[model samples]
Target chain A: MSTLSLTTSIVDATGRMLAKYTPREKINWGRLGVISVPSVWLFVFFFVPFLVVFKISFAESEIAIPPYSDLMNWDAEDTFLSIKLSLANYIFLFEDALYLDAYWSSVKIAGVATIITLIVAFPMAYLIARSEPNKRNLLLMLVVVPFWTSFLLRIYAWMGFLNKNGLINQGLMAIGIIDEPLIMMQTDFAVYIGIVYAYLPLMILPLYTALEKMDMTLIEAASDLGATPTQSFIKITLPLAVPGIIAGCMLVFIPAVGEFVIPSLLGGSDTLMIGRVLWDEFFQNRDWPMAAAVATVMLVMLLLPIMLVSDGQDKKEEA
Target chain B: MKKTSKFLTSSSILGFLFLYAPIVSLIVYSFNSSKLVTIWGGWSIKWYGKLFENEQIIEAAMLSFKIAFITSCLAVILGTMAGFVLARMGRFKGKMILSGWISAPLVMPEVITGLSLLLLFVALENTFGWPAGRGTNTIIIAHTTFCLAYVAVIVQSRLSMLDETLEEAAMDLGAKPSSLFFLVTMPLIAPALVSGWLLSFTLSLDDLVIASFVSGPGSSTLPMVIYSKVRMGVTPEINALATLMILIVALGVVAAMVIMKRQHRLNKELKE
Candidate 1:
């Protein structure tokens, strides 16, 4: 009993000592450890890169190795630090019809492709989500399996299928559908096909997740109340799936806007994408500032739609 | 169960067909004995054999593998910390910036990302005189930036589902915070880390445009090699390469699924 009492007193003393240090104080240091490593790394790599791009966009292209004029000119003579900023790069993008057309075409193509994806993915996702429990996982897995395959290779697969002498044309010719090949590849049609095909999983998975978790009882109640299937779907299912729809559209649209691989591989030379334009400016034309300008503008173009989407979602939530 | 409508069922079938047909054709044509890609001569493994004999492809694959291995390791470590912050840390200063920087990479255009990273490297080289020339190092860093976000999202989702009471209990039992994390939290989130690592590995391997912007002479990745070749035109050898990559990825996906299912079952059993 004496030994037990001694141990209890020691334990009690330690407990008091532990209580002296609030968990918040201890967790603050822990928070710093967790936050600093990744945040600093992102700041240096992710955030700093954009800042560099922004800075470079303000500088002019030069013949020197870096191919861009320094924004801040430090003159060693007479204690001078001169900062030169130019809007010429941004102005040049406006002056060129090529840049304007590329930007517009990118938005149109991505927007249409996103709509197609929504039309294609919604029903398919619904099919999987509404399936028997045993088959639901398998169905969803099948949808995502192709996403794991190499993205370039999948786009390449479309190239093989859509080429002039490619499989589809060859098979069509063998059956004597037309004397001429359909001229499908190196066209906007092929670009659309590639984007839709490659990004299908992204569109489907989100819709499936949202649909699967939906309460079935609500649907049954709507039906019991003598609402038409279409009416019930419009009122209940459509509104409920709005979050998934928005998520899916953004996923499909964002990368599709600045696509290089699909457009370059399967698109005609005449088909202009901002990504290809940026590549040409930076690599082919060796104009780093112009490329930075193109990228900055493209980022703004991408963000506007996203902000609007989020804003609309916010208003809906408030309502 | 509600009967699936005919339209939905048919459309789903068509979707699967659209997704699988090209891949199936690619796989089937990989074995074509004829040099022509579309022509189906009797099936043979000559392209696969030829692929092995090519020195350029072999070296490129090795370099890609090395880069991917390094990228995944760095991404997982840094990403776990980011994920912990997102999931565990209450509101903090600069959380807005942190969240934006993290999620922005997920949907950001590859060209923009690639361009910005390349510029950052060039500026750093000019100012700090480090990363002297772009090569595998630059590619790995660029890849880790995006892959880190992917991992953080995965790990964050996993952690959101985690029970906090267990950590509280561990602390109450006199476990130090560091030990509590390593012992209690790490084990629970190990599966996410493994999957995140694998995803980062594949993403690094598959990247083309970003690697293109940052890569220097003699350090061409496999995708870079393939991109140049495929740009000229499709080749039987590329079909062979595509076939091999698909097979490997399919196996990996199946393995991941099995592991995740087993983990779920184990969790359920433990709860019971």
Candidate 2:
């Protein structure tokens, strides 16, 4: 590799001698060679898997013995071509109201939860960010510490808190806040609570970064200009923090859209989300092709937020 | 006159209460001695004791730790390398595609990722007679795939922020590229590596949807076990386990904060 690159560079310099283009010796081809190994590793292990998923989504589902089919059978031409690739799965997706309903419900739930999460997390993250420098780290740690535990465990903890005769209801009834239990568990409300609760940190972290990096002098200058606190916040603070806010929203909104565990654990039977539907199709219903179609749709829906966040982060980092 | 302070105090307090109350109640009730999960007949460590005695839960916890440790290590190694390349290498053919692929898993829902991976594994097994079975190995592979993306993003960002002078200086001093990396670049990015490893470890341990989809019948992680137990019936033992996890996590966070603080102080002193 080195010899080839060296010869190429030597030739390039000579080749470009009369071409008026400058020659560069340090091509960093060696670094690329080293980098290529892991790049290929990710491509094979991560990228190819998704490609296979895309391929399978266009194929007809076939039943076989438990687990999967025999390995050697794929080598044969007849068996290979017999797999029958087509768009039947995509057509099936359009025909299924359940799949579409689940997708809509996922959007609604995630949308509401994201709004509520921003409302709940913004003030706290703001206060923490604006706090004294010595205490700032401690406060940030406190916010993130909850996330260090199992995300699923946090959702499960809500089970005890939301169960009928659970602490929240029992306390409410004892205090005469309500005449009856709120029926908090196994409801859409419960699913919303779980999602917001689990993803709150994700929102806060980016918001905190944005807020903490803002110049306090700007707010002070606005105050000096006789602007009210709320005015200063809306004009100076919020606008400056828009990138962070966008980043945070993108982070929370994308994953929450396809969130399954929270809804499955906390949602009632009436609750419908695409993730749950996808899980049912693949695992319970044993409809691999249809499930793949659902996943493909999710992949498309998820692309927007993913692009938004990645671009937002890149801009923030560059700035 | 003092309305804003009062409102701020009240609202902040309310927010804290809302966030911490459910978790506190869950922790407190784990000590309840009664069979009824909701009722607080008395405080005792009986649930914790029972949790220890449950062989299945214990095995699951051990299995979870094993998987988390292995997968996190694998993710850090693969991800750090990928990160280094993306951070250091200038634009090349397929660079955009490579970067997009790295970000895909981070945004993809766990269920979709799980299903897709399962399909991939089945396809490979059918094609090449390799990875003949699905179980622990498959679970590890699936987790490493997703977790590697996260680690790569973190480490890549850190690497991008790094001063390029050190590596250049090392290279000019007659050090080989490989030696320059091990001596200077690695040390400079060590914090990001540690952060990546911890993040991956936490993710692997926290995962349930992907693990459930990919894990074979006999190889259940702690979260999987807890999920099944919760589905079967609410158990105080789960609360006990959760509370213990909280304690461990809290300690880890506090330690991390202290280390970061010390490092910051050292950097300041060096500058002075």
Best by DockQ: 1
lDDT of 2: 0.80
lDDT of 2 by residue, A222-299 (tens): 999999999998998899878778877877888898888888888898899888898888888787777878988888
lDDT of 1 at B211: 97
Number of the top lDDT candidate: 1
> For all the models shown, what interface RMSD does each have?
8.0, 4.8
Query: Which residue window of length 10 is worst by lDDT in model 1 chain A?
Result: A310-319
Where does model 1 exceed 4 Å of error? A1-28, A174-179, A305-319
lDDT of all predictions, in order shown? 0.88, 0.80
DockQ of candidate 2?
Answer: 0.49
Across A210-265, the per-residue lDDT of candidate 1 in tens digits comes to: 79888889999999999998999999999999878887888889989999999999
lDDT of candidate 2 over B35-134, digit per residue (tens): 8998888989998999999999999988888988999999998888878777886544555556666876776788888887888777888769768878
TM-score of 2: 0.90
Write the residue-wise lDDT of candidate 1 on B30-142 in tens digits.
99999987777899999999999999999999999999999999999999988888777655555545666677788888999999999999999998998999999999999
Q: Is the docking of candidate 1 incorrect, acceptable, medium or high quality?
A: medium
